[model samples]
Target chain A: MTASTAGTRLAIDASDLVKTYKGGVQAVRGVNLRIPAGTVFGLLGPNGAGKSTLVRMLTTLSAPTGGSASVAGFDIVRQQKQVRRAIGCVAQNSGVDVQATGRENLLLQGRVYGMRGVELNRRADELLLRFGLAEVGNRFVKTYSGGMKRKLDVALGLMHSPQVLFLDEPTTGLDPEARSEMWEQIRELAWDQGLTILLTTHYLEEADQLARNLAIVDQGRIVVEGTPDELKAQLNGDAVSLELAAGSDADTAKSIALEQGGVLSEIGVDGLTLRGRSADGAGAVPALLAALEAADIHVASVTVARPSLDDVYMRYTGRSFNAAEQAAAHAAKEEKK
Target chain B: MSALADTWYMTGRAFRAFLRQPMYVAFTLIQPMIWLLLFGQLFKSVTQLPGFGASNYETYLVPSIVVMSGFFGAGWGGMAILDDLTRGVLDRFLVSPVNRASLILGRLIVQVLSIVIQAIIILLFGAAVGASYHHLVMGVLVLMVATNLLATAIGALSYGLALLVRREESIIAASNFVLMPLQFMSTGFMALVLMPHWMQDITKFNPVNWTLVAGRGALGADPDWGPIFENLGYLAVLMVLCAWVSTRAFRSYQRSM
Candidate 1:
């Protein structure tokens, strides 16, 4: 298949990639992806959607069972050294040495990447300051907080000034505040350094905030691929939600909403609630209120908002974001067994 | 750059970590000291046996203890690999431009250096207890080379196994399983002539026995250069073979990952 070349030069290119575990379980099945330079490309997936597996292949950690991948213009298998030289990987698990001082860890990473003498020390100090880790650079990593360790992991990955950076779930277990800080750092790296970033995340808000373009992956394949705005625009309307009194007849409320030029999206049985999408939720609300009044349905509350990435994901996958995440976690556990 | 300079830089890191925990240093030396104190006295009268070469048991037993200590120390060398794997330090190195073989070689070199230091300490303790080297200077140099080679081979083998098993418990179990039998089967405790004919035949295949023979030749009153070279040759072959196998195991580990 002809790969897409719409943006800048490709930093990562994979075609028909496949990876199978030891017990004949296919972790990644015939996936293809292209990431352009100087853009943040988010790979959004439920836990076992082969996002990590794909990252591993692209980073040259593992060879694909079939098909091929190239990172920074080097074949992942045949030219693995060059691939490794060009790409930095902050893996899903924080790969920091807890016993070593944060500065020592970065220095060792620089040495391993062939940086030497004055240049290595200078770069290590630079990264420490850039990542706000200069104060803790001399402290052993075991004393570091979770966020600090994660920042160190990222710093280690970037010691060589790699062309492409693969951050696999950069904020998986962080608190809300830490997660936001991580997002901001990621954005700064992409914007300030012009580094091509491929980030994998299950958080819809994170993807929407950080990615210029994203691919929604599920069951080891790309389900949909587009910019976050483009994907949200696919819904093509504003979202309206209504909460009615108990026993107020949700069917009647949905019918009322449909008659008011809004498409009935969903209805909740317990609260007798209705949700819909429309070009103009404000204009549709009065007509819907009139219909509900004629039907004697007591509307307790109503809300209208722009279509969020959550709604877009639910619309495309027919599953709530949380439910999809739970399912993905379950699949990953089963695969591990 | 000189290879020694490269090896020293790598070895220095290991030594720094070793110095951080005095308890580990104490633990490493305690085992060899036990053999020196207890086993040396127990076999004090055994040196009266003909062709034993050494007039005193302490003199004979010290060299054996050094070789034994080196082997025992080498068995635990894989702990560094296991620790690195658990901490993701190995993966960090794998993703970099460093020489892949150097990663393993550097660690093994550090292990050998550490074992050599332990050997020197044991030798000094033996000298204090009235044990003397046969060809003083040559004996010291040969003992260092032989013990380092033996320890390096075992250490590299353990490292390769660490990559295969990828668990501390399993690596310890496998190292113990290999080490205990070799320690007993070799001439570490008793001379070859004192053992059964069957055991004597078996010692020919044991690398530990070769180390003991080489070390013993250096410490005896009448040093036999021929048997020393022969024993050194055996250990040299074992080192090459084990290193080759370990490299293969390392390659398999990378493939599996």
Candidate 2:
């Protein structure tokens, strides 16, 4: 990776990076990533999947226990100041000083990166205008709404015109409307500014919508890496969902569905709804219905759709994203007991 | 920009935030006035005792109370740092290429500024109540500088404790634990000769006593030049040591991250 020519150096490159905390908790375990210059990359995962820890290491806020990485072609460990100067990071928590005005915060951040006088003032104003915060730029952040505070956080990160911008869960706590607005701002930051962006998100839709290239992280490891469409295409099948009647037997229905010729895997049942994949959903529906009828299991309704990123996750992890999250939470609870 | 410039810029941010809280500043400033008025009158008769050097209680109480204000204000300075740590503002600065010393120093500078303002207010209030300085303007400036040094040193230690514990409750407990004992042991509220023999000996080592003695010499009828300069030097050395400890605590925090 280091042998790349000057013109095409990777914006961010990590090889076998690991981070084990003081109490033996391995937050990030040997994860590797290569993000191209001037592209948007996503790190997608559930709540406890180490996405935030990986960002911390990349941003130079925390040190990795093993291996090495570089940002903008500078070694993260040895040239940390250079790495910091080349990148901007908007962390998961809002980092804006609530008592200070937004413009003051930006000015201070710009100064921290060595900007001063006219250059700093101009950049701070430009960012406020760019993020649609110019009207309230001089008002104290304590008076701003949640969405406005988050916007100020992003604006502060961009105060130095960094080459690589890292947004960790940029829209995690926002409402639906604010989330879409934040998505627009992120897109403009990457597309118009030509900045390389490495975003971490737990929302699959956000990853699919904003990231051109993404890696699905689970349990401190990368489970899958590709463009969202490419990942979805890897599951070369249609998703077939069957809604069973209230008194229907789910085990018998699953066994019946498995007996059909085109059924790809075990049925996934969420309460009365059972789902499976098929090579050709339309053609397999008749045989699937006949098998269920033979077993005298009643089905209320049936529908088929193209495979989504959710299906892609299921195909790789053998469980849905929500189920995996719940199981992880339950296991953690039982461990505490 | 140079490191000094970065520290100044960061200090401006903290100073602006402090200005926004008018009510907080008002309360802190007013509390010292209440102590000076209430305690000065309550102990006015102490000046009539033999071996007391001052002609009036207000003259003697003014300088001590001014030093007390600085001590009290600087003691709780870490609450602001705790707020920054919880809100992620400190981490934002940590990720930047800014000088790490600036982060700690910038905060202490703000506390020193507040202490200076409080000292000035006390000075004005004392003059209104018939307290006159020994050397007038020059002596007033010395008192201000001495108070600033003491506040900066104590504020630095408060920030160090803030980073070490990172819990509001524990920081407050640690602050009171150190402050209450120091207040009882120091010569801030009384003259050295008035204290018991053992306490007078122990007060020789109290950092707060160094601040008070310097302040009293500046405002007394006849200023003692030697002990004032010596104690001011001690305050300067203590300020450097406290700033170093605060920076070390910051390093530990980054490593733990």
Candidate 3:
């Protein structure tokens, strides 16, 4: 179990991790990561960015192609049994057995981890209640709603009270309400249990809300990594938006706005909207107003807001997060075919 | 403490799931019963030939029915593997500290036990219709071992196929395409002498024929130890081969993922 004994702060550490599938599909290409204990670390990436593959490797489902990783101070490859003992994995696919009841699933999982007798039964019941699955614990999982099934999957993963918990796209196919509820549960698990969590998600808002620190991965590599506030602060300005009056010429308005004392960051012709970044939106707004007035462009409304994670992603990638996700998903489907 | 305690824990879950859907159990039992009642009646008069060893047709048919029920039940064992693969349940177990061999062994053990129970029921039905075992205890023991060995081999083979294809439809199609012909070609429904000389020669290599021979040896008035031991040996070898194949299939499935 070649693990770093340098203090106790690091929960998970990886260096130059590489995973290549058959036919030379480089799913994870030389990635490096470090996660602190008791923090919710988010691996932010679009579909096919190798998030699930990395999770699988770390959890010992698959071995890495190159480099090395350690989870909870145990080498992922050399001490796979210890790694398996220390980490709880809630995979992208629902792992619950639909033929078995919720309680049955948890009990089986607990027993697999070497828990038995009274301790196993107590843990199963406790998790059922904690995850809000007590009511349906005796019912077959086939009758469970999608949200309930996913929750039970998480509960099953948590049956052994592992030190590290891995959640791969925990709310990918969930409804909005269910997604929020899942987010809350994830937060509670980290806060209440002090469990180190590693989560992967395509949703920018989900990463922004839950992650204390995150890495943006694209095409099997990390593009950037930092706290959400630190990443957003990299934009270096307040974002100012001007909603032009109906039928206004957006191109002409954008040209006039660019001439003002701020940098024109974006121009949307469809909505006749103009966006600019500046140190002082209050002063820059008047200057932009004067410029637009001189250009004879009517403005319906104007507002300025702080730079968000989306703006930070746009600055780095030159594409909206959602657009990148769509492209990645399309590429994944094509590869499958 | 028990050799079968782990098997029980694992088999208990499968049985619970099986019991949850009573219709599935009914359907599983019905197919074998049809083969016993209908097929047995159709082939009754054929046993009048010399060296048939049984005076009554029911007596000769009972052992075949027991082996056939085991054959049919074991064919569907791979469905459980396919279901687990599709639902991500197998992945969950992979990451846990669960004994991997136990997972496959448990399912095979459950299917074998279920088939044995069904064989007992069929034996009782045969008795009611003028069938009787000369060595009843030894016959029951022989049937138990024969059914268990046959079911385990077939179940493991099916599990291997399930992992190879990783789809329910493919697993079902392959099992059906393979087992139905093998059952018909074996001595499960007829005496070896009743088959053509070429077919009789072919039956020598069929594991199902070995099961039928062993099962019948225990039930017949003239019990034959030589053929019974030979059949048991053949089945033991086949069981090892199928178990190895299934383990390799499981590894390949994990690698693909």
Candidate 4:
């Protein structure tokens, strides 16, 4: 597998990619993305947002039902093996053999890629050292800590030095310390090696911290795509949050909040809590309070904060990210019953 | 790497993993020894009956026990595939350039090796009990070859079910359903002539009987070369059929993915 030359050429170019599984579940719908070489891109979404389905299709693990995608200039459908060779995938689930030692796991992965002899051994050793797994390299992976197992998963994917790496929900289950360590490692991989990394995550903070560019996927579609700062900056103001008193109709409060001039977007409500965007949050507070009181809505508290990825998601998807997540969970629970 | 080279590498890895589980190997060997001693003592008078194949019941029982061990051991080979599947190790192999057939074949090779070892242990135990392989060296070699082919064929079927079922409880349940009935229906523990006329007719088509008849023909003072070669032919065909079924199962598994 040859690496692409340094240029503005796209490392990953996917257009209107769609995946409809058996039983008519459409996991990915009309996803379009263009990621340039040597960038850390994140596909940010809550659970069941189809982030993994898109990653699976790109990695050649699952086939898409419609549209097309190309990874490292190889067609995902016509040149599947080429795509598989060009890109490394660290799936959501850990893929390391639990009974095998960390070193043996790396060697097995390298051999599967057709690497053998002294060169394969040297590369395996180098990765163990790089991922801080050299100390326990001989121990079976079942005995490794969760963080160490995750590190080895990443190390396995990097054994062949592919041009592009796909890390699906890389930090979903890691503790804070391990998450930061993984973030540092990802930063180094992109900065030092110039590796193009496509990372998927549900953690908005993870995307904000580690990704140079990101797309917010919700319910099988990309709601918005840009750098984290740019996406948040598009809101152009502070987020005004208020806790309405009990028995207050959130819809009525929203209507009152919208009537106040300078309200930039819809008022997001989760039960008695309401939020909206405004250019001058402090200046509009008194008018908003008066309007709410006049409408018989009692305001318990109010706070103004800088826009975050959450607010950006709220702006595009028309629902608070947290609420969408809760609703999805509740739906899943109901289905289980 | 070529498919053969890949198969060899995977076979080595699988064999090492199997060796690490010393308890599993110990139990696998211990079970057959118990069966040989306990069952041999219990049925020692069966040779006195007419139409019995041999005077020494120990010699008559040795070959059947070896074939039974091979069959029983191979019936659980699917558990290995299930472990690989649930752990995502199989997916790692699937996404790579490794040969698909080699993955299934490598696990079968481990089963074949285990079957040979089990057969040797039984043979040594029979020797200690005054049961001799009059053909001696050639008898042991032929028995190993027969057990190896039988184990691999059954192993292929076991792994095929693993890929299809993809559940441990289901595989264990399915194994229990097939193994004992298969053994009793064949001439595994009794002479075909001693069985009912109907059982004798049906046992001729049973794969386990083919293995047992071939294995017993190679043992004792008068070695029957004709039936041994003929039964070996039947086992060779069964081996190819099982391998093809496993290959098709792998394809269905990929499509499901």
Candidate 5:
């Protein structure tokens, strides 16, 4: 929580930020952050893990039930207006007006920040063009593809050119191409304009690819925080993942590998899959594969790779990443309905 | 920009969105006119009954119909707010430097505009039927102002309810629950004299009845300015009070989040 970030000018600084909602639901539990200016920081988590809640507090959309936070050096509680003016927020949910044209949404957003007439129109046109939405600027947003709508959401956030941009789950529902495009825009915003971006995403690749530093949030708390490379490097060895064909006995593979495959160690078998870490992945692969095949295990696919964010998540949370995600997805489904 | 300027801009957004959704606007405007026309025609002969206020049912119902149109139109104000809430448009504005008052005022203006449009059409339909306006400009002017004030109150209350409920179905159910009974209890359909004694007592406390009394007073050839101003004054105060409550409801919404 006290780790010093890289720069003197911290864009967002919070100490022990806590937001406990009604009925004893602690949505955010004492999270601290120091995000330097001109960089991207990611809050990576599954659904219902309080990433959005934390972002909401930082954006001044919801007051912290307990702790304090300041955005752009203005206290969020005492100086909400300044905090609001200093930050541009794009929530997990798309905020574009479906009935209005893309250009219209941007212009209104500009006026919301007190920008007027010529300046507002110029900013709107610039955002539309920069986001590749210039051609369809006049069309209703409802008709736009999911990716296009998402780009407009990001464009709308940048309309007023605030000091920091907060993006919550920016790539959640976007198609692959659109997600890549949004990534490009985000990268450009940080590198080109020297804008500070606080992005929240569940996608591991999103954090690894874009974030200068990231934190994994689960059950209303930050489990781990560091650069993606640093977090993955915390573990000492390469990650080994293998899936078995249907009806193959995972126990037979695990016992056979431990007994015969001397090179492979610390192996874990879960249902039809075996996951473990290896000191020497290249050296262990041949022995592990031979032992599993000799034991009549139908090895579906074997992968030896670098440690990923998901592995870091598993190491810290003691639960499979996808399992947490499936549960969060279910809760989110029930919530919206 | 000032909150007032922001409100103006926000109002433009709401107004444009209302116009853009042609189908929804068409239906909202049309439903009340059908009620006015049918109520006028179906109950044309009811005016002959004892203690009926006017020579024809249409003329007597015209002023009440104007209030009814405004009330009904204002009820849908919640739906508009709910659309923005569920769609995250409200959150976008909340997280920005946008004024909290502007968020409420902007939509209130749009809701009043929507109700007033319907009020004008209902008035014209009334004139087309048996209803007559000797001082057309004066009569329409009073009703327009009255409609704006009353609709503002109704719209504010609708927005408060929408914030409290946060569900579209609840808004619809709550609007119907509060509105249907209130409309029937007011002097919208029948003369107060024709109603049961108990119902008449309730009508005195009804905001809709207060509006009806004001509208009908202004509609007369020899209009009574004092009583009309009195009711309009009450409605203006109610508008202020309701707007305050609705604005405070934003706190409740944020608390829920």
Candidate 6:
């Protein structure tokens, strides 16, 4: 990480970044990230994983409790304004002022960056058109739909042509359609425009689909870091899912499947579904099916998958992502009281 | 240059939001008139007393109303900052290359502008009710500046309170607690000479009364620029002090984040 070089490849270079809130809640313990320029790096985690806290420190919204980090090679603490100038941050919470028109927000954001007159207007217009906000650009943001308001938030962040972009759960509250639309926009942003983007998302599908490289964050630390495919490949085998008949006993089905297994890792069973792992999945299925059939266990269907991000999470964290999220959510509620 | 530009742009953002609620503007201008018209008439004979200085009470009440209007109006300034803080807009601006001063200045600009406009209206309403000043227009001008200085000071303090507490009920309760006593303690509602000796001593230190004295002093036939400027200087000092306290609150905000 060359602080003086104008052409440093690491758009974001962080080391041992930590954030402990005043009440001693160590939201972010010790996390390090080095994302190359023009790559979409993702931080995937559940609630209370300190994803938001880390983003806050990196974006210069919060002071780090310890350690150091830099964006665009400028120290986050010392060169905050430079880091702020080099990066555009779209926080988990939408920062749009609902009272102001979409265009008005853009103009103000552009002006804050020292843009003026016609050039500013042209950039604002271009972003409005690009984000499909041109139709509702003159309307107050309160009137805009969730997707439109979110698009405007991105537009506000992009007004100054920042070198790096931080999108923290950018599609968190959008409906499926809007979420996919945002995905396409993010894809375009990464593929065509080539900006270094650091996105934090709890949605496995979101991280899998968009991020070129990602880190799995849990309990304030990076559990694993690699490309999505690399993480799933670490699972190394087939994820066999058995949809048992509606009336079939889940407990009985689990034991029957476990009986005829080699190199099988028991993944959990939910209601009428039983899932497990096998290195020789295609070959092992028939015998396993015959054994269940002999026991009068009626099988509805069986399918095999090449490990998902969830499976990778389960393997590393020793718990499913949803369970971790639920436990964290419960703890958060207790802490709030 | 960019820092000043950012502050100007921030003011524009707050002003746009201020305009969204026409009801706010209505209440801001009209509420003070209720005090001017009704309270001025109710105490119509107060000017007959020695040391009241004016020919009638309404004329005396006009400058006081201008002072009170800005005082109360500026007290709610924290609510807007709290709204922005909760809405994530404050973090948006904070993470940008925006001058930190812009956040305070942005809201202050709107507060001052609102008080200035409303102060002019209050002065005119006083005139309509037979409250004539010796130098009518110039007097109103001085009152506007004085009132705005007071408003900016209060607005900065409100913003500081918001950043510190980050709670609505706390800001509202704090505003009421601070404003109610300060409102009556000053010469805003009573002639200074008629006030209790102890209360008059408090008035000497009260920024609100300083604003009143400055505005009222300018309206007299023989305007004393010396005392008026002195009061303005007091208001300026108060503004700077409040601004310092408010900016210090930002450090707390940053650390808490």
Q: For each candidate, what's the DockQ?
A: 0.55, 0.82, 0.72, 0.57, 0.75, 0.86
How far is B19's C-alpha from truth in model 6 (Å)?
Answer: 2.7
Error of 1 at B239 (Å): 1.2
Tens-digit lDDT track for model 1 on B51-101? 655577777788788888888888988888888777777777677656667
Clashing pairs in 3: none
Backbone clashes in model 6, listed as residue pairs:
none
**Model 3 per-residue lDDT at B146:** 81
For model 5 the local lDDT of residue A17 reads: 89
Per-residue alpha-carbon lDDT of model 5 for A1-337, expressed as tens digits? 1112222488888889898877888889999999988889999988889999999988888888887877777888998887787888888899999989999999889888888889989899999899999999999999999999999999988998888899999999888888898899899998999889999999999999999999999999999999998998888579787899999888878888777545566788887888777877877888878777877787889899988888899999988789999998898899889
Global lDDT of model 1: 0.81
Best by TM-score: 3
Flag the better candidate by DockQ, 1 or 2. 2
What is the DockQ of the complex in model 4? 0.57
Native-to-model Cα distance after best TM-score fit, residue B209 in candidate 6, in Å: 1.5
Give one clash count per candidate, in the order shown: 0, 0, 0, 0, 0, 0
Candidate 5 chain A minimal-lDDT segment of 10 residues: A1-10
- Which model, 3 or 6, shows the larger TM-score? 3
Writing each residue's lDDT as its tens digit, candidate 4 over A1-337 gives 5536323378999999999988888899999999998899999888889998898888877788999988888888888877777788898888888877999989988887888999999999999999999999999988999999999999988998988999988887899999999999999999999999999998889999989999999989998999998998898788888999889899888877776655646578898889877877888888888888988889999999988999898889998889988988898899889
Q: After superposition, how far is residue B125 of candidate 2 from its true place, in Å?
A: 1.7
How much TM-score does chain B earn in each model? 0.91, 0.95, 0.92, 0.96, 0.94, 0.95
- The native-contact fraction of candidate 4 is 0.43
- As a whole number from 0 to 100, the lDDT of residue B4 in candidate 1 is 45
| Model 1 per-residue lDDT tens digits across residues A1-337 | 1112223388888899999888887888898889888899999987877898888888887879999988777889998877887889898887887867899888877766667899999999999998899999999898999998998999988998988999999999998888898898999999999999999999888999999999988778887899998888888578777889777778766666666543444434445667766766777777777778888998889898988888877877788888988987787798789
TM-score of every candidate relative to the true structure:
0.92, 0.90, 0.93, 0.90, 0.90, 0.91
Give the per-residue lDDT digits (tens) of candidate 5, residues B1-257: 48888999989998898888889889877877788778877888877888976787777887887787778778878888889998999999989877788888888788777777788888777778767775677777887788778778888889999989888999888888888899899888888899999999998888888788777878777888887888888888888999888878878998777
Q: Give the per-residue lDDT of model 6 (tens digit) for B14-100.
A: 888888899987888789889998888788887788887667778778888888888888898899889999989999988887898
